[model samples]
Target: MSDLRRAAEEWLAQDPDPATRAELRDILDDDQALADRFGARLEFGTAGLRGELGAGPNRMNRVTVMRAAAGLAACLPSGGRVIVGFDARHGSRRFANDTAAVLAGAGLRPEVFADPVPTPVLAHFTRAFDDVVAGVMVTASHNPPRDNGYKVYWADGAQIVPPTDAEISAAIDRVGRVDALLLGAGWLVHDGAGLYLDAVSSLNLGTPDPGLSIVYTPLHGVGRDVLLAAFERAGFAAPAVVPEQAEPDPDFPTVAFPNPEEPGALDLALALAADRGADLVIANDPDADRCAVAVPGPEGWRVLTGDEVGGLLAEHVLRETSGDDRLVVTTIVSSSLLRSIAAAHGVRFAESLTGFKWIMKAGGPPDVAGERGGSSPHRKPDRLVFGYEEALGYSVGDDRGVPVADKDGIGAALAVAALAAEARQGGRTLLDLLDDQARRYGLHATAQLSIRVDDLSLITAAMNRLRAAPPARLGGCAVESFDDLSHGEDGLPPTDGLRFRLAGGSRVVVRPSGTEPKLKCYLEVVLPVDGDIAADRARAAADLDALRADVAATLS
Candidate 1:
């Protein structure tokens, strides 16, 4: 704590920026806030730094940003090209430009996007530039307005993984202060958003019904115009904008959390759906890399979980492809329904860590096309044919055959609405089709329990409590086996998580979110159905209830 305090003081003393100095003043005056904001140096883990925006060593300020950029530049191999992108956040655009300047000063060529763009577009562009060894995106995704992030991607257009993260972090540690370096002019800026839109347009293999009433909200981020343009270029109807969230607002006033997966983040979009009787509601986080969706349900409007949407989209992508060596990908934290769905279609299924970066790696090159040739970076199996996480990220195609491995929320939204239209033509709802999927490939029910903590130590304590004493039983079923993810028992690298297997193919996974101060418990219960759909649904629902109670009892 003293070392951290000293570091904060040193930066505070020299910070010329008025805003940084003001934030530093606040930190010095408020002991608790100081403890919270400067308790530790902001972590630059496997995914790099993301935290509340403020002016402390532990916050997302100019000092930390410059230090990180310098470290990244120093860590990169000599002669490597670096690409940068930013979202619509408080200091996102400035941070991005500053990072490029820092990189250029370090003698590395920095290719920066001209304006605020989605993280996924940066993901795609990372691979487009030859000799590019690393990529950086300034975004906080769905976090509160006061939060910002620096997501580092590797040369492969995927977020930095494993040894590279440690390597980069070590480089960052070597930098004593933010003022130690002088930056040079960055390379000529590129039209990253235009390229991203062009790529998405080329991946329109599925026929979208132009008549379907679609509503879209960028959730006050950078994706509104690009997404709308892509929809139109793909021969799909232009989406109705949720007037309140149509324009980019760093404050994100309508929602507490900008993530669409959150219960009420899509309230405005859902309300719009209710008012227009729109066929579907589509929402993207501030940067537009992740998408949130809503479908008109029997009870007002129902928001679909990321897994349900992924599984449904996976099925759609497979149906559109003709590859014999088809592979569908998702993260382990996501629902296992995709596995069963993939198996039924004779397609291979692969699981990675809970990030689109991992899924994109499993799918292959970010810029390569899938079965069909396209220039966008979102193509599925053929390139990155289809990949998603429970956190609402979906990348449709690749850039070479398609272009980049970036997630295309706009493309995914169009695909979902199109699929719903096809279902409507068949006299069925998406839920009805999902029921059919369940009946064909056993009923799959998945749920997540997330526990938020105010302190870092509390988070560690919760994980320690779980590991020191494993659960004997859950949902009335005996705990068959348990695996500590930290030990890498699942043929994957060690991660801070735990997985428990039940007696009847049921599973529970407990892990702290890498980017958020929360513990997440994922539950998957399978219901075998030979002839009964109603009974299967009832059994799955009951299983979820029991599992929820068991988790609550254990965690609480």
Candidate 2:
């Protein structure tokens, strides 16, 4: 027998799932298929293990999840409790249960959620307790239906970062035969609804009056029940849910992609909003860790970009909260308008790498992040009032300044509702709030040029070309300075990206998407709004379009 066939047979021999075993048997006679299955194992990254569901280590399956769970167990001290949760996706429940069993067998207490829950609920439970050393969530977030993922969180209620990921990977490599590992069964099926719902409901900065007509959809994932409960508790009338997507459906039959940001994904919600004459539309992606908001204007209904929402939430949070230590944060690729807003409010502002792991870590427990000494280079107070990424991930910290340390779609929805209702009281719309921000902080318009690729080498070659022969000028403006982000300058962690600053605060950042196979170019142009606001808006849009074209040409 060939070596690849032998390897496949061995994997089949110990495969626990009957379906996967049959899968291996069918592919055994196909050399190319066998090679594909056994050629690689999923590598642990900052986001943890994620891939297509299949029968090999290269895929997400029982054996792979067990190995990952064992690796995580090995990194922690015995007897410490670990939390496990799953979403409504293929193999997610099984993977979560397997994680609990492995953690239990490793002599750690395991607390598994009784039902499939949103990703943020698991993060909340992990951070709310002192006994939990770590947490594992089985979800792919907004990935395709055929994919599932494992996300690891530390006791801080944030996703694992840095050396911890490296350490977990080493422990996974040290694992032996999957069939030889002992299994345990003392883990509890937990219910975190009450704890999480109450906390998130309280995030309502103010009671939303019944005048705010709202339409909501969970997009056939797990956000419906929890979001409805939170909204009702927050004193707002129950939102009209998109009936077709009100229940948890693992197949996600309605949308091509489960992410709310995808075009046409929110068609149903928008339709429902129009039918009901609703003032606002809210959507939570498959796992409910991210939120998207849509509003009606003179041009009709449109979904607000994440940066716009971030700006509105930051201004509202800082204005409503009474604290001298208020701090707000956003990713480097996000709009710098938040910095200007923070300055006007006399609050602290910091920038972190893309993910919430770095955001929460930098925002801090106060004692750990101070004076740019140990792990951080800035003075981050424990008062991280708000943090967001341009990709619809937001954390609106409560009055205590203690957010879940991760994105909370449910909480963000409530906060947005409160803010929208307040605006309506003054006969204004969400678009007006955005316009006010533009006038206050100069019109900061942004766009994106994203390129998808089937071959991974395309991305590598594109990055190399950009670095080797940089563009001198783009969009009729000279390139003032170029930054290679991998060198870890400006107190930021080294990442594979490039930034080009243009003449009038217009800039472009090119980087690979962390979860998808795409090269995303973030473009922002800041234009002064000293004259007619309408003319200024039109000029800003034109400038942004030009910048986007230049960026795309340079990258291509």
Best by lDDT: 2
Tens digits of per-residue lDDT for model 1 on 1-556? 4655666687787664689887777666566777766777798977789898877777898878888998898788766789898888999888988898889888888988888887767877787667989999998888889889899988877788777888888999898766668877848697746666677676745667778888889989888888888888778888899999988899988888888877788888888888898888888888887788787876778787787888788887777775645666788778878877776776556777777666765643332223121223443334346778877778665222334565667667667877877887777778887777787777778889988888878878878998999998999999999899898754556788888889878889999887778989999898788777877878889999999889978987
List clashing residue pairs in candidate 2. Answer: none
User: TM-score for model 1?
Assistant: 0.91
- Regions of candidate 2 where Cα sits further than 4 Å from its true position: 363-380
- Over 217-291, each residue of candidate 2 has an lDDT whose tens digit, in order, gives 999999999998998898999999999998988899999999999999999999989888999999999899999
Off by over 4 Å in 1: 1-6, 26-34, 363-384, 398-403, 530-535
C-alpha positional error of residue 436 in candidate 1 after TM-score superposition, expressed in Å: 1.3
Error of 2 at 12 (Å): 0.8
